[model samples]
Target: MGRNGVDRDRYQASQSCSDRFQGAFGAPRAEREQQFSKFMEHLPLAVSIKDKSGRFLFANEFMKDLLAADDPVGKTLGELLPPEEASMMAVNDHQALTQGLLLIQNRVNDTYGDERIFETYKFPLPMPEKRTLLGSISVDITERKRAEQALALKQQQLEELNRSLEQRVQQAVDELRQKDRLLIQQSRQAAMGEMINNIAHQWRQPLNNIGLIIQNLQLQYEAGEMDSEQMATEVGKAMDVIAYMSRTIDDFRNFFHQDKERQPFVVNQMVSRSLDFVLPGLKNSGIDVECREEPNVSADGYPREYMQALLNILNNARDVLLERKVKQPLIRIAIFRENKRSVVTIHDNAGGISDDVLPKIFDPYFTTKEQGKGTGIGLYMSKTIIEKNIEGSLTARNVDGGVEFRIVV
Candidate 1:
């Protein structure tokens, strides 16, 4: 009973083991093959299998649709695609068969008239007869390629725009700097001309006095009435007049000197120096000048530039006074401290600026004077000097019976 029972149990166990092996190796293998074939047929990629001779052994539905072909099995790539595409695919197939496996990326036009890109993975499939089949799976990469290209183009455009913008900004800055330089140069020229005119006016009286003194000295010496003491006094007087003229030249030179750095300067000194430049002309024009100052009032700036600004204001005032020929013409300058800032006001009794012309007075090249008499750069340059160089403000307004120019530094 034991031996027969043992034999029967062994047979049953052997049969059960055999069935389990068949299920594990056969059933699942077939199921997986079926699943893979269905996946390849429906996948969103072109799948193909070709013999080493480039004859199509299999083609998935996607491949057939891509080529606009019906049945593709047993057909060559040359029969299913354009000559160019077929030749390219044949070369890849040959490479896969000879080189074991190959990867290729190419572009083509689909049957639907759309451009497409594909990355194909091609490998050899070993057959029972030692023949090789080329297996290929290619995904449509058209959208990805297009997106990458668009992004590259956009990046290039942005870079170009940035470059153009930088160039334009730099050009604008350069042009502005040039304009500033021109304005400064022209203003200096105008001030120099005025300085020369003042020098002439200042020299006139001294020259006339010297002529009178020399004539008298010659007359006395010829008449034998010249004494040593009288000669000494007369010479001393002539020397004093010459020294005065020399000092006047020095004052003019200093006023036009180029100041390279900012320094604290007394407001009254700056005013007096500027007035010294035009004093003779002011007196010649019968223009009475009055100045009042608050003690210790000082400003930190280029003194020459400040003096030039003051000269511009004073000259403008003098011009207005003479042009209008107002009775008892007068220019009044006052300097004081206001809100921790040095303030200067120059006003003249030349009938206030017309309301219509007031607002544009400070604009470059704007002037009420007739053409050729005024360059119109004086006030504009003055404002530029105060605001830009001195970090100050200059404003003008009609006060009492005249125009008043105010500078705050």
Candidate 2:
């Protein structure tokens, strides 16, 4: 009887423990389901579960916020979205559920006098029954779309600005190159003129000597006293005059050919050559030239052409001074170095240029000389050569007694 009572007590205790375990675990599961429902109530994106028939099985807090209603479950999407959108959404959801596919769409939602764009994805549930469509996520893309559009507009504007700037820069470069070519051609022409003038002056003295020699030869021949040696000497003198003229032609040819190529040359030597070309005219016109020795001023490109430009300026000054009948027709040429720049100053005692004409001196076709005497391109060409070709500067200033042309490179 004692053994039977022990077995019965043990059986009753086991049953009681099993009942307590079932109750504890079951109540917690119910509580957990309630908590999960509360959590889904406050999601930010509209959350919904739908059946294959496009009826809502569940709608979360966000859905309620979107619809401004409660108990939206079991309702068709047509009750929420506009008729067109609702029909489209229902079709997309039905396709996703039936075909086990995913659908993504970008669509606009209108509310309160504004439009909001959303990107929505409808995906099928993995359940085999195909009765449930698992989930849909809609993201607000309105601000992002606006920003992208703004960025595209700005990019287009930037491209346009770059194109305009490139065109303008190219135009400027072309203009500069055109100016350079014109200046070079003008320099060649001016050098040719000076060379011709020098030849004319050189021939005068030689022609006079020849004339005197011929007169003597004729007198001796008529008297029947012409000597062979004397004749030879006279012939030799005449030949020397011809040879000198030939050499002058050669020099002029070389000067005019300066546009062929560029090479480094001594500045002083170039200056000397230029002076030789203009010296005869200067002497004949009685214009005194004073040039200072420039030991340190050397250039690296187109030595002959550069010297031609300088000589043209000096010759122009000389002509101006002589034309004005200045009592002391003086042209001062000086070259010095300052701040890594070559400075050439050509000043003349020609009472300075007139204020009325100063501003137009460097303009093409603007000259103070009478017709056929000046082409008016000399100063303009000079400025172009110095500034555009050599990357230098040329400026004219009126001093107390004369006009000074300052060139810096």
**Candidate No. with top TM-score:** 2
**What lDDT score goes with residue 191 in model 1?**
90
The true-versus-predicted C-alpha distance at residue 206 of model 1, in Å, is 2.2
Model 1's TM-score against the true structure: 0.62
TM-score to true structure, per model: 0.62, 0.62
lDDT of 1 by residue, 255-326 (tens): 667888899999889898888889989999899999999987898999889998999999999999999898
lDDT scores for all predictions?
0.84, 0.73
Clash counts per candidate, in order, are 0, 0
Task: Summarize candidate 2's per-residue lDDT along 1-409 as a digit string, tens digits.
Answer: 2435334433333233334454656656556556555656655666666655565656677766565557666566788777987888777787776676564755554445467777776776543333334467676677898999999999999999999999999999889778767766765676677678888987788788888888988999899988998889888888888788777778777876655555656666776777777777888988888989669577656666677678779878977987889986888888777787677888999989878889889998788998888788778877876776677888998996999998876
